[model samples]
Target: MAAIASSGVKPITGMLRRGLILDLSIALGLGFTFGSAFWYGYHMPRTNARDNFYKKLEEQRAAKAGN
Candidate 1:
């Protein structure tokens, strides 16, 4: 009985095989979006240029204090 049941069981296939292309396309788009967002937020000049901004501000403050 067990052998007959095992023989009757077919391989699992074809449930979600239709939309593979669409799935891959969405994955690629989201991957690029998240990657660029990470790069901009952490590695872009605006984020790293904050030190320069503070230095300029301190310079202006010192000039005003000296005046």
Candidate 2:
């Protein structure tokens, strides 16, 4: 009787550990995907727009100085 009970417990423990690891891996993958999407969709566009604005302003200043 004791031997049978211990055998049952081992399988349950192993299944539980596998389930936990699967859940963690899925969470990590989702976090990386969302972070990349945010960096490309939101942050990069804003940074590019600001840089362009500065470049145009500098060009205008140079034109004014030339005159």
Candidate 3:
């Protein structure tokens, strides 16, 4: 009886540990993927646009100074 109960508990604990690891890996993977997508798709374009605007403004200033 003691051997049977111990055997049963071992498998249950092993399954629980595997399940926890799986859940954590999945959550981290999704977070990294979505975070990368958002950075490249949305944030980068806005940042590039702002940078371009500043460059154009600087060019305009240079042109005015030249005149």
| Candidate with the greatest lDDT versus the true structure | 3
lDDT over C-alpha atoms for residue 9 of model 3: 50
Cα-based lDDT at residue 30, candidate 2: 99
| Tens-digit lDDT string for candidate 1 (20-47) | 7779889999999999988987778776
User: Between candidates 1 and 3, which one is better according to TM-score?
Assistant: 3
Per-residue error (Å), model 3, residue 28: 1.0
lDDT value for model 1: 0.84
Per-residue lDDT tens digits for candidate 2, residues 1-67, read 8788767455555787899999999999999999999999999999999999999999999999995
Clashing pairs in 1: none
Global lDDT of each model?
Answer: 0.84, 0.91, 0.92
Question: Following a full C-alpha superposition, what root-mean-square deviation does model 2 have from the true structure?
Answer: 2.8
Model 3 regions lying over 4 Å from their true place: 1-11
- Looking at candidate 2, the ten consecutive residues that score lowest on lDDT are 5-14
**Rank order (by TM-score, best first):** 3, 2, 1
